[model samples]
Target: VNLRSFEQAQLVGSPFIATNEKNMGGLPDRTDDPTEEIIDDLVSGRLPGVLILDPIKAGVVAAETAIKVHPIRKGKSGVPDEQGCIDMAYNCNGCGNCQRNCPNDLDLVEGVRLAKEGDFSVLSDLFDYCLGCARCEVDCMKEVSPLTLLMHAGRERIRNETFNVRVGRGPIQDTEIRNVGAPIVLGEIPGIVAIIGCASYGKEIQELYKMAEEFLIRNYIVVVSGCAAMDIGLVKDDEGKTLYDRYPGDFDRGGLVNVGSCVANPHITGAACKVANIFARRPLRGNFEEIADYILNRVGAVGVAWGAMSQKAASIAAGANGLGIPAVVGPHAAEYRRMFIGRSDDDDTWKVFNARDGTPDQLVGPAPEHLLTTAESIEQAICLVAKLAIRPADNSKGRMIKLSHWIDLERKYKGIDLPNDLEKYIRVEADIPINMKEEVHEYLKQKNWQPRDIVDPTLLKRLCRT
Candidate 1:
């Protein structure tokens, strides 16, 4: 079921139901005594095994009844806890910092502020303009981490607003899976690499597209999903081709596929499965299962997911890993660290994970050392993953490429240049000139100290004694 439909079912006082088998019935009417009828049917052995309902509605009712039953004591005020107030304050302050530092001038501050004030009318509006580049957090010294906060808050708002909403049924679109060109088929092309994640207040996911472009130049298929896809305008390619184009490269300069929204991450997994299937059928000495096992155990056909806060990415990684595919998450390390050690004001710890064995192998460090914004680290990790994908004994097989060479190539090919609009955001710090020699000489003179037949030309020149 889609999110909208699930939410609507909750709002209309209807019990949200899930069943293993179909053909129960359509939605129940509002006037019908659903609870009584459901109970009667259950008692008579006519109902199914399980039934579910929206817990939020029950909680709301319970809270309301409790408030009505127990009035606030004499001097006590009726309000949420101190932690809730702190969270509200933190969100407001962090969002304010994000807006101030945002290069694109997004109203993140206003959106979060509204959320704090229990106003969500503009929540979706705020999300629509977020580039998800994560630059806002990058520039903030307050350690705001607006991206995750926004996603959580947005999801909550969506839950509240869309509850009891209904979605009309529609036929599922049949999507085709095809290689871009003869190069892809002739073993001349590198396999696809899809970078999938969410776009919150930060723009960190934008780096995925940059990485994709680099991978594309090396003849690798590149796919992006979720809010990350939206940032780069992946919903539609430059040539107006559907996301599932026969030739992704031809449709969009080269090799960029936006699978869909967050839930559509299964598309990436399916694509990888298709590639594995094709590889398995090519009389390559191994079947699909064997190849999958090999890739899972030996070759690193790994999925790298950035921004781990979203359950969607975690779910996708689990599915892929279950299929014997290696997977890595960029943000889980920080989460683990935060879970273990409390957060510090100046700390910027980011984490990365390897979920190949269903056990997380985490890499945690300062953000500058581990996270995005530092291209060198990301490049190295990608190179390492690629190197792991190659079979050691196969001399004829092409080896995985190194990230250093890729980085060198990128540096050589694309010179340092900023976008025109971003020029205003650049600030040049002033340098103070200091004459060390003159200062030293002045100090020496003041102390009535003189060198014994020794003179420094630089010092003498600075002291006007040359």
Candidate 2:
């Protein structure tokens, strides 16, 4: 089930799929939009059914959508985005502070005012500019939410708009698992990057294409889902090839896999779990602890949600983090005000237990520096993805190659040829790229880089036989 559109993604497998912004109704806590009828089946874990009078939208949303709300004019500057969201008793005072808070410089006030007057052109046009950070609502003194106005106008304009889209491809195929599994274990594949999130980065969606290409060219598997998948497809090269047309839709090295919609997000992590079952011959049931440990130490995967704006994006990122896979969220994600940050400077933070035996290892280096961190730029995010892909169980050759790409990306994007702290991950001469051996040797000497012991690392404390 490729999630065709958020505006009309009704499902039957409980309300789990409703976590996406597009599937924005049927939640127990959500009561403001009382107009929709809740399907008892979806709530009771039966067949997935649609929630009528959806808070997200009323009809199907399509690509290449063009809307005109009629009678365009300059709207008032002081109005809150939603007409009833603000309390008039507090007095707005016409400060226009919310406009300044927006990262994309969208005039939420004007868009709301125009929408109230039935002129949706400004609102419709501004939709591309709004990343749904809800900063306007946050910074406002009277608790005004601009996202509501955008959603309202969008629903009103797109009611009858239903475009033919290929249905969702429900799961990551077993063949894909079989094809990519061994190389991943052997380190031929440095990492699997799941690029997700909404169109919240606004007009800068091309950054996704460039970032995906950088990894794809290096033989990294790139996976995408939901609106971010659609947005990335919007960009094309001079040859008129989107990333989709350029790469095979395989879960292999250098392949591009689109799983369709946030509903398929489980498949992203499920693929990781499948690797343990299908590739390593691990027990699938009653083996979560061992499987999670394997993923953390050996899977060499990271998630990049560069334009995460909604609560659903945050929830998804947190879920991935909980499973021992690291996630890098966009700057707007910082507003969530919660992230598990690791101190790479402190040696103690990187230590892990060798669960396969009874021995303990000291300072394995920052394979995953942070479980969930924010990247301010596309370059930083790209480099972060490379850095996070370093796993405790990576072989010497794999580590060397992964480090080479990370260094290259940093040099290309941030203009620094070598990371300031590079010695922690250098296990041996082979771990350093042959070209940079001398330079790295001198650098490691200065930093007093003591080669740390890494043999059969699994973070599960219970597995230690001591």
Residue-level lDDT of model 2, residues 260-281, one tens digit each, is: 8977888898888888789887
Candidate 2, residue 399: CA error in Å? 0.7
- Winning candidate number (TM-score): 2
lDDT of 2 at 198: 80
Q: Give per-model TM-scores.
A: 0.40, 0.71
What Cα-based lDDT does every candidate model obtain? 0.40, 0.71
* RMSD (CA, Å), each prediction: 20.7, 9.6
Best by lDDT: 2
Residue 353, candidate 2: Cα error in Å is: 3.0
TM-score of 1: 0.40
Candidate 1: stretches off by over 4 Å: 1-187, 234-253, 282-291, 294-300, 332-397, 400-466
